[model samples]
Target chain A: MPAICFIFLPIKYYYVRTHDEGVAVNKLNKFPKMLTRMRDGFLLNIGFAVLSIAIFLVIWYGLSIFLDTAYLPTPVEVWDALVDSFNTPDPSLGVTMWDSIMASLKRFVIGFVLALAIAVPIGLIMGFSKFAGMIGKPIVEVFRPIPPIAWVPFLFVVTGMIWGPILAIFIGVLFPVLSNVIFGVKSVEPQLIDAARTQGASKSDLFAKVVFPYTIPYMMTGIRIGLGIGWMCIVAAEMIGARGGGVGIYILTQANIGRYDYMFAGMVVIAALGLLTVEAASYVERRVSKWMGA
Target chain B: MNRSVLITIIVAVLLIGAGGAYVLLSSDDDGENKTYDVRVGYLAGDLHQVARVVASDDDVNGGESLFKENGLNISTPFAAGYANGGSVMDAFAADDIDIGFLGSPPAILKSLNLKIDIIIVAMVNSEGSSVVVKDGIDNFTDLKGKTIATPGVSSIQHLFLLELAAANGMNVKLDGTDGDDDTVFYVQVAPKDMQAAMDTNQVQAAIAWEPYGSQMILSGAGELLLWSGDVWPDHPCCVIAVSRSFAETNPDTVEMFLKAFIQANEMIDGAFDAGSGETYDRIITLATEFSGTNETVVLSSMEHMDLDYQIGDNFETYLEDYTQSYIDLGLIPGSKLADRDYANVTEYVEDLVQVQYLEAVD
Candidate 1:
């Protein structure tokens, strides 16, 4: 049975991929070069994501069926569970998959934004001034190694249950933004700085026109990385002790109570979030980079 | 402009990185710290009372100070909190906690592996769990091959569910632990998420203890399948434990804590004035503060739960049974703890449990 499922999925994915390819080929012959290029690039990116997902599911589903263990759910089971969770209203609490997703996204955005606001200025300073970087870099490095989960109790007690998740997510998101901004600032060429300086530009003018424009590309890169870290940190931050309302809280709660479908559903929401967030961030990054001509 | 600028930048980055590393590293290791403070870790559930008392209440502290004039300094290492018992054990190994409460399975597994000098201060609860099945499901036979959720793999619920599997003729195996081929399916989820999971139909069944089990039953997500406490009568679920070295050094503090915990348990168990406004107020506050449920719900739910401090035959027998289950689950090697005197943890527990303080205060 496991073997049959294994054989079935790849064949299905292969057919999907080929059908996409055939469509792409048909369009390519008629469309202009630039339009065709854009179409293929978009199709290829979507294809990679789907193919990866399909292959992973095939392997996971097959192994679970083979092992026959309760510990590991097959891909089909997880998918089915995901659907079941969305369709059923939780009997105990009114929390649905949508609720968990929204709660998590809200937390992620707040933390990520706070981190961005703080990390960018400090990183820009570190990049421009040798002295500031020297003083700040060591502090950033020390905190980076500590896992965000480690701080759950501290933030919970200090801030109480209300703001603990935000505090944790802030820590999780802070470091990446700082590091990336520093790299971005440093990457701007000396020639650009020299040209601006030669033009009698003031300190602010030089930074605003020369350094800032060049570094936006790097800033976007940092945002992308920071957002990913912040997203993953949702689980730890939402450890809300007993007042759990976030997706991580939702997942753990569901899992404990043997609500496999809801657990899977929560996981799917998180996964979709990661994918959606990364894509959105990436799109903004491309547009910004293009505008900056970096 | 030449060598000094480059050197300064390099030194600054290195210095900041080193400082960050120091903060992370020092937070983990406490074995060498000479400060004679009792760092206690507890699962956040019932310990809110203790936390409130520790931070504010004068009588509890004053009564406790009779044993030792030195007031204890308390610092919570929030990172290694009471969620997963493993986190507490990690802190213990690092010398962060003097006393802590952990679920039974993890406590047993750690005891077997580390040979760490720790003793069971007392068992927290000595009752089996209630198996919660989704609404409309009836009896254990209806659960054959159904997906279920238990706590962490080494938890008491984990062991009992496996025992349930074995009794029902399905061989459930722990991940990376056994070669057994049980057709039963179960996923391990934390207790807090069970309600949300049920609401979403993520699992068909779950095994929960006390307040949570009661919560599920009340919420209508599940109906009670044989309550384990009813089935096995006093199966141990949680244990309060202390680091041996820490306990020896901070004997007075240990006794004070034990007294307070026992008092809290008794207060929870003793029949209150059925009509006094204070009776319901405290229960509601605790339920809201700890469990996030309204007072009316917790006040009603408290009727079914037996929250007491008595150490009885059930604690001893369940310890043996649970420890064996840990061994069978391959969470702990049988050889590691085959010789420990389970029947007489009393000798170890006596020095740590200051019954005198509780007796004096009561």
Candidate 2:
């Protein structure tokens, strides 16, 4: 995928031809009006998102007030809790919400990078070789259906650390990348390979120049999808040992202690974190695809 | 143009998200675990009668007046009830109780996890615990290579068996294996299916506290192996633990609680004359209030009267023994605390108990 990304990306740029080259001239001609239009669009989205948040908070508050039993503390009570949590001079141990977030992120990144490292090469090998495909296909099929959580104990027993949960994320992500790499490799036009051969390119060169280029986008797509799934698996992964202070642990601990407020808080934090991750991933996808002219 | 700026933005967002998550995950709450207007957990069979009595009693500080002060609708006591000590322990861990009654084993296990701060306000009863074994197994060692059923891995019954095994040089593995030839099979099974487990020869013996133990004995299915209290005399069977901060912030309220409990204990022990009209009414009311037995049956249930309501001074001995058993079982770290620390449990207990409360009531 990396070779293909290096190869086809140039081909994409050759056709791209600087679509935005005339932007400065166009901006000068209608700069004020165009800027205002873009500004309006941004403001409109901001308003809609704000309204959506306000509506959610109102509904949540109403439900909480109507169910003012301790089992269902009102949003006001939760808000007060949130405020009280911050008001203390030094946020005590376990009160470190930032620490939990960083821990989860660190685990997620390590698992993600490790998955990519293992999956991409295996995927490339399986895509190009019949023997690799035949041997790997059955194994992938058998393990893919076994949920990431099933690997948690295996990971724990092996690493004797919190890495078990992280490994679960890696395993979950690997299958998607494997399947996508195979699809991407197969999708490379055979004529391009033949052309490369006719042009005195070596077998390796043909593969490097023609096949690799077509597969890069597919591998990227797989990565995006796999990472989404990996994040979901992280919570199950963090359940293995005592040092497990991930977002999932946070939620479960609150649920166990019947602290619904903290549980809700943890859940909300996860959602927000997920949104931020997706946004960053989307930005990278857009930038990469644009640079590749794909 | 500015990659560092983008990186900074990403890092900042991540830190904020991470910070929120850490606070959500790590917030240590040792106090204010009271999540309900009235979080009340007790024996399932006893709740209805107790609710009626509390609904009627005006003298008890947080009984009837508690409901009134909280403006709780008195249509029915919304108290949740469970049949087993394990479930109550789970509920307690979940903060599903402002106050609840839990068996000694669950309470002891809970004490290991420092944040819980469960204080035994009073001893509920002692003789209700019994272990039953197969009819042919005349002695404890006779049931080698056979499985014994327990409700949970850490129930009082379960721990009693563990304590017994440790004393007798047996390894209580999860699968009920003793490395040597002599083995007593011990495994956890759901409480409801215990009788069936026994009947079908799935389990060779069962260690259960009443009313399951008493009920099993009555059925003539098994012979008694040992009463758990006899395993460790005056072992503080079932206990009533209130939140430490609840006791601290509301000391007078706690004292009032002790008064009510002591009065009930005195009445149940028959120290007060039930023949007197006032005493008889209170007795009938209490029998109706706490146990939910019919006034006649509840009064009769107290016939084998040994209400040892005193909280023993041998706190260190129980803690050391209990913590050591957990350590030996590999349930907790052996080096978690020292002898002095166990002796001065008052670090946690002082926040929960005002011995003066019990003494004053006495």
Candidate 3:
């Protein structure tokens, strides 16, 4: 899915920005050569994506045929399972893929929002003030390397099932965003700050216009990395005890019952969702970078 | 250009590829793959499977395990122990273990669905599970509109929960999304964590295999609502299974393993009097260590459970009923029986179980 995303999302996102939003690229109809050249490059990328996906499918099918074990289902079988998951409830899990995704997505969004709420402010302060950084650095370093899954048993008991999984995602997403925000603050351009001050800008005005705008792109980068880790944490956490249905729970149930095809289907859903989120972050990063004239 | 050399290379590649494919597709070895130990797998920290632990004891067996005593190599595979029966089945799916002790439902559910050809050789234990409810949960009806914990859909204890709910005339559902006020919803929580889950109010009740029920009761966290025997008397829980290829290739080894297992079961049975003799004290200590619980909990657990190795006439019939329950819950597809090429559940059970190992023990 990530490999295909390297091809597919560029075209999809480009179309969404140019055609749907009627953005500046559409207004540059006068620059047909540049636009046409951009389109051609994108078309080549899409072609490569299709070719690679086809090759991957062929190899998968051939391996399934050659190995001839129930462990590896053909790609077509996986696709069918994936399609069927959306339309019907899994016999073992008794939840459709849509239901599972919604529950996971709710946890992810809530967790992401919570991370942003706490991490951003802390990161800004730590980066801006030496004393704050001194106090926070030791705690961050101590907790950073401990895996999210190590906390599953403790979290489930303390926070209960619903919030336990959410907190896992929060833990996964917090550090990257926090660290990146710190890096972004520390790396803010001295020239930009100097220019803002020379223009008679107040401290608040300089921070809002110069420091914050520069950090948006970095925050988006952290968010992209955090999103991937969040998915992984949620899946691992849910495998133990997820009260309401989740994609991880769905996959685990299928695996427990020896339904490899259904398990692969759940996995494919996660891959696709993870790719969609990263691509969305990439899109936001692009827009923010352009707005900041990067 | 170089036709002869090219042909030779092609033949060599063909030979190597075919050899690799055969190795991968083949189910068992020729009794020559014994670099490690016997690679026995069991559910981690489960007291119901203490039979294996007893068999593995060097002290009891006088400087070697029972398997070693019977002239068979016994080794604990580093990755062999699993948290649950479903994981033991997964290890079987990967062809990682020669023998495993897991729930019969997973043994039935996975072997048929995943096409893993493991045959159940003997019974491990039965009636070793109970439903523990938090304070104020007096009866089954009090469980309405609440979330309960079980191992998972494929576990025998989960089926016990469903059957007990139905026997009391309550509606039960998995996924818990559209459940009404009278419906009981279930979540998957490992037995080791059930006491914590109940203590935190994460789950109102939990149905788990013993030492957990006994552990929860002894901890003063929950009260026992139903023993598995109360639902279905002496129903099968966990059973000993062997990979078909392993059994077929290493028949003598398999026979020795069973002999050692039977000896362990006999020893365990003799120790059932609890602290009356040295054997009883040893079993209590072993049970406490193997289950990661207290001596009090182990003694309490032993009272509520039976450790039987024999599979009599009624077991196969109960297996069919268990399969039907899985089918009814949509956990197992009705067509899976046909997929396995069995005419019905009866044929499936007959093929699934092989009593020859147990019968040939003497």
Candidate 4:
């Protein structure tokens, strides 16, 4: 069977097997209608995305012609440059475009995953305990406003070039994820927790069952925002200094050498990576939401 | 949409359209006899003292007044600064400034890339830079697998480092990463922070221009591994460059500017020749004032540098060698050499060096 049909078959079998005789007929009929609505929605979204991208390209092409400078390369030139970079290692930088992208992605993922791992647990504790909240709140507020670029020099001194950029990204993503996760935990309905406690649930059970599921959506929201911040931080951090070739370093080296087309190509790759990762995060969010029926 | 909102949007669009049109139209005002603000950039190093002396309007010690005396109405100068030559060219590429006092490597690289149409007008100074390493690291061979910092990848000091490494048969890598254990690593640290990086043991050594290198030695943070002059005697370091458009439009003004620069160079030479009097004191004072460095550092750095006032035969040789070094380092395309042999590279280097203004000055 086709994949789409296979997906629907399980739903049909489960409802048909579980529902009462009268409800079974109604549910079986409703499933196809719901599936049709979902397919249409997916198509409509794809259509809008394509239309928006086409408009953006048209505007970019118009501007490039109007500017008429080497600095402002046309879309076609940038595309050619992108293709050329992917195919060949730029002799000046000693790395291909794919290598640069992979290097940047590695740093971004490591830093972001590390930030999420540390921030979520601290946020949970801060939300659950008043003493923890009081102690952590001031530190976060004080450090959060300082820009990530400012930390480059200090981090370079402490971590060296290889790990400095990674740590800088981690610092950039930490606060937003932490604060939002705290907000997620605090916003959990108190009545739900009280009810769980009344049902003979222990503290750990109440947290696992009641608090955790309620906070997952908010935690996802934090991760989404943190991912964006981490991307921005990695670029700036790499520009300050990098040992291996990264997208940011590649763009900067190209700019310094007056290869504006390749610079733009690097920028496009970074944007694409950012979009791809955010889409992946959204996919995970949707799967979890479905599991929780949220 | 509502009628009021529609009208407001139309007005905003018209305003933005008009503003952009004005910018586009006004850019053409750089015609004959049209005076525009002159933005001059200089590195924050002692090598740029000649340009600094010329740009300043301080009556007691300013080069702007001297230019004014020669009937060149140089509008009050706009000063742009960078820590090193690499960033100076970056500013030029961005159109942040029209003229720069920067090192030869960056100037050559910028012209090769055609980012800015620039002509080297005059030589600044030479032999002022050095390679300094932490104490107990006695020689270039000791730097294997150790980290060293320079102003930037394309700065002349970086070229000097690479040339030295190549001479010693040492493998050098520009990226500051964990590479082969036998390779040396180089990172870009701004000149101002080179001392700090050395002091904090962030880098075991640094190749930098004065007075940062001098500061490091004075503070006991490092010892001189090699003088730049020891590698290439009287090698060209910083040169004054002007955008080709600026030179074309304001030929007479540029000539006058070069005349003033030559005069300042002469004055510096005369002071150093006197070797210990009011004249030397004045040069040191002016250098300290412009460089924002202490008097002792400036004095010590001056001892190491020879300020060349003229564009000489050696400049062509230096330019060719530097360009070849760039090609060898893979910072520029080797195809620049594919069509040409050594003589052609010399001719190409000569094409970039416009000496008419400097020659016309005398």
Candidate 5:
């Protein structure tokens, strides 16, 4: 676990040390040295990631052998199932793994983006305007704690199958992002607001220059948390009957038919996909933070 | 933030916490579990497994449930029943039940897949399920490029649809979210949700066990395309499966359970023959209550379903054919027979379906 976290360790240092010399000749002369540092860091990250996964696989293999049951399939068995999924229609789901992933990915991305668009602005308004808070807080609080899976039947009935799973993801992601952004806006320093006001800034200017930038980090935190929750929602959401095959359905179908190896293979794809999304969010955060010099 | 208000809030929170815990624990009652000598599981709202409801009812057997008359205590852990055969098999694997009534395909699928030590003790019913389609969709080819709902791949309904699609030489697969490619796609929906799925146009057709099919027809949601019986006469649908270890440990108890089950089948047969009399009305009422459908749907369902416990040579052949179909569809690998120390599908089926307890009865 710690080895995998090391991947992010060199990222900040690599960027923080880059000198912006405003087109100076010395910056050009030092480019090769910087490239060497980047290459070293990249290799270290890759090495640590490989080591972490290797340790995980060893532990899993040992446990499977120790248990000696068909329930816990070996990594080799899972790997074969995973490879077969791409080439053939899944034994249970009747679609290639690639097809499943694409369908699920489409739902996830659509749901995630929708959550961000709707939630962030509402959170900002509710936090900033007391009247808005009076109205919005009650509604948000009422719906926030309801589990996303509980809405499977209703969503399917109302939104139909194609949009049902997507809405489930939307609901799962919405609350966390909304709550965090609200907290972020409210946590903005009063002193900073006063300074902006004294500097003859308009309401819009004050928000864009100070409030928005300060809230970025907190909003990102909410997004990271929301994305994790969103992935957890996929299984239950898609279980409502995704219009297309999905990892959640694949896992369920395999388990239903007593194909543990294939079930495990579905789980692996979901875990890998989840990790990729989280990493992508982090990378975006890193770049945004650097550009803003936060 | 007043001191008295704070105390009141804290006390209220504790009260709610205690209430929630009590509800949770009471729902999964150990006392009730201990009271039953044999715990049974069955599919929810499935009209095919009426023998179980019939066997457990006191009204039919002189004010005592048939199990009590046979000197055994039988109870269902889930009052509402499982949603499908797959879930029933899950309950057995989890040791939540000693016996289960579910589709034979799932009994075969999960037993070999998880290596769950269970034996097929008896057949529950033969042909009760139906393939229902929206109006104007008359045949197999018309079903192409449309969404159809199934309980899940673990269901015999799914197997039926697969076979139908193959016979027509048309392609069928899980819903790819894009179904314009001249391939019929199926989606997994609980049988209870079949009507809702159809209403939303998410599925143009759904294959489900009666009285769900009959219920939909009565409700005017869809029309029946084919009764399961129309396709395969005297087919094996749901069966009674017992945990092998449980049966071995309590052979007499298992026989007692089967005895009551066989008696229940006889009672059902008599009720069907009674022809609008009191016994027939009683059976309809019991089935309606058990399956949460109207008496109309139950009566309609009875006409299509054949309640039988026979696992004879013909039935054995049908089970073999079902196993072969699964292998051909890549649902179950041929290697699993060897994995379980069976030489082939025939051996696997023979080992799986044990009629010893049924024979021991009476």
Candidate 6:
């Protein structure tokens, strides 16, 4: 028991020393680091963003005046529309702006999550094994270049209107996630694999511990990209194929009826939803990959 | 800078300079030869054959030279073709189009929304729309629980479908759900793709304006479940709509344009009355040329449509009823000036139909 303690004590001491150094350094850096972050982080960036948006609004207002067409509804008019849409339901569309946004978000989440579930495993298999990669390469290469809208008719025929847009979005998101996961797996450090093997780690254990951790940052990147593409795809698919209520459908329907103000409001809602989702994805990445020091 | 970079910069500058010179010279030419540009929006279907004949200078009645004869130096009219009435209304709102030949519901919707202040100039065609279904589906009740496609929610055909369903006591569900046992699911499809959707069994029935409905019947993809005229006899389908701004700014031009269109409509009527031979052949040729459809489809579609240019009392009643249907559907607000009620809605519809131009032409 003493001998065992002696052996374990050195290892424990080494860990403690490294951990203490890390903690001390973090403590020493915290104040200046926070100051630097404050100089460049949320408040400052938000201020700049607000300024940028103000400039955009000014330009838009100027153009609206210059054009003087009903199509170019002013910011004030759009605001009125946005307010009205939120307050009262559009009888034609059968829903308020809030309902449309919620419906769109629900479809987006289902499609995005479905894409991730299917793509991640296939990407992992392709990345970790040469045989799988060889088989998947041609299939991915072929389908990756096809635009999501091209699948609308086929999806509509098979799944009907309700699921067609979601499936279209899933297809749009799948390729980006798959490609990035494959890249992350293929780019895993050779030395790390050798080290794990030298320590008598099994193939499954190496994949579970090393490959997964290494691939997570890349997977997050893929997810971020997939999410953007998925948002665009959801809008287009819904515009073309959705029979029910969605933000894209609302925009299209409004435009069809010459309600440009409502169309612009719907567009603003889509942009805000997209920005929030991307930020959510980034937040998840930061939380999950904190050990990578991102 | 490196020699290669310097060379590249010089080449880029020369290219941009050449392109700029070309654009400047071309714009100067355009400015010098500026003709009265009347951008007209019309549907890509046989309903707008009169407008097409006037624009294309192939009027069988020899009305092509009428623009110059009226002291208007109009060039070949710019045709802004759209797939449906809704898009034509959109173009009118955007000021991309000054005149439109579109369906009644979209025209009325736009006027009610104050999107485009348009005057209903003339009737383009009537009774050209139909509800077509797969061969085995015989009646409106048989369409229950089956999917049906229409051009849009605010389309005249859609309104017709709703009325038909209501008459037959069938529930029409627009929500994206599969309808219940007594409900018919309604999907909005572009008129161009309605036949394809029907062919693929994606939709059991399609309610669309001609020549799509006619095309479906000609192709044997579907049979006519009900003609719109059979539902509402001589129901107003398409109307000639002119921007109020255009009419106010250029009343003579609008009058001249309407005169030419009315003449073409007369020619079409004369040919239909004659019913065969050279006059009818010429009308079919003009329609086929403008609509980008084949001759057989054009001929068959014309059989279902009455190319009447007059907007009579029947038109006013039709417009009022249609406006009330849209108001009840919660499509357009009930009224712009008063409370959301039938009287107010009728008042609003009255304001929308400006028939002084049509009357003056008459």
Cα RMSD (angstroms) for every candidate in the order listed: 18.2, 19.2, 8.6, 9.1, 9.9, 11.0
Query: Of the candidates shown, which would achieve the greatest lDDT relative to the real structure?
Result: 5
Q: What value does the lDDT take at residue A246 in candidate 4?
A: 90
In candidate 3, stretches whose alpha carbon ends up further than 4 angstroms from where it belongs are: A1-40, A198-200, B1-37
lDDT of each: 0.63, 0.59, 0.84, 0.77, 0.85, 0.78
Best candidate (score: DockQ): 5
Residues A1-294, candidate 3: write the lDDT tens digits. 564555566556655656655577544453445445745786656667777878888999999999987779999889998999999977766678999999889988998899989988898888777899999989998998898778877898889888889999999999999999989988998898889999999978876787777788888889989998999999998887776789999998888888889899999999989989988988888888898788
Write the number of the candidate with greater DockQ, choosing between 1 and 5.
Answer: 5
Cα lDDT tens digits for candidate 4, A145-187: 9987789888876776778899998988888889888998899
lDDT of 6 by residue, A107-133 (tens): 888888899999999999999999999
Tens digit of per-residue lDDT, candidate 5, span A1-294: 555445555454444446454555665556556546755887656766787788989999999999887789999999999999889977667678998898889999999999999999999889888999999999999999999888878888899888889999999899988998889899999999999999999999987898888878878888888888888888778876888778889888887888889889999999999899888888887877887687
Q: Which ten residues in a row have the lowest lDDT in candidate 3 chain B?
A: B27-36
Candidate 5: stretches off by over 4 Å:
A1-56, A290-294, B1-36, B177-182, B275-282
Q: Rank all candidate structures by their TM-score, best first, as comma-separated numbers.
A: 3, 5, 4, 6, 1, 2
Per-residue alpha-carbon lDDT of candidate 4 for residues B1-362, written as tens digits (9 for 90 to 100): 99999999999999999999999777635665343355677776554455446434445244335555554445423353565565677667667777778888888776665345677888888778989999889989899988898776668887888788888888666564345766778877777777777887878999888887887888888998988999899899988888888888988778777776676676677777888776567667767777668888887787788777577778889899998878776666665443334245677677678888888987
Model 1, backbone clash pairs (residues 3+ apart or across chains), number = 28
Please give the clash total of every predicted structure, in order. 28, 20, 0, 0, 0, 0
Q: What is the lDDT of residue B342 in candidate 4?
A: 24
The residue pairs in collision within model 4 are none
What value does the lDDT take at residue B230 in candidate 4?
93
Candidate 1: stretches off by over 4 Å: A1-294, B1-37, B46-75, B79-81, B173-182, B271-280, B338-362
**Model 6: colliding residue pairs:** none
lDDT of 6 by residue, B1-362 (tens): 99999999999999999999988877624643443557777877544445446434534445544444443454323354676777777777667888887889988877666456787878888888888999889989999888899887778988888898889888787556445688888777877777777887878999887778888988988998888999899888888888888989988678777776776566566777888877578767767766667888887887788878788778889998998887687676555435323257567667667777777787
Q: List, residue by residue over B1-362, the lDDT tens digit for candidate 3.
A: 59999999999999999999988768345555432247788998888888888888877766777777776667656443797777887787777788999989999988887788899888888888988898899988999988788988888888887787788788677644887777888899988899998888888899999899999888977998889898788888889999988888887777788888889888888777444677677777888888889888988888888888889778898899998888877777788889889999899999889888888885
Taking all chains together, the TM-score of candidate 1 against the true structure is 0.48
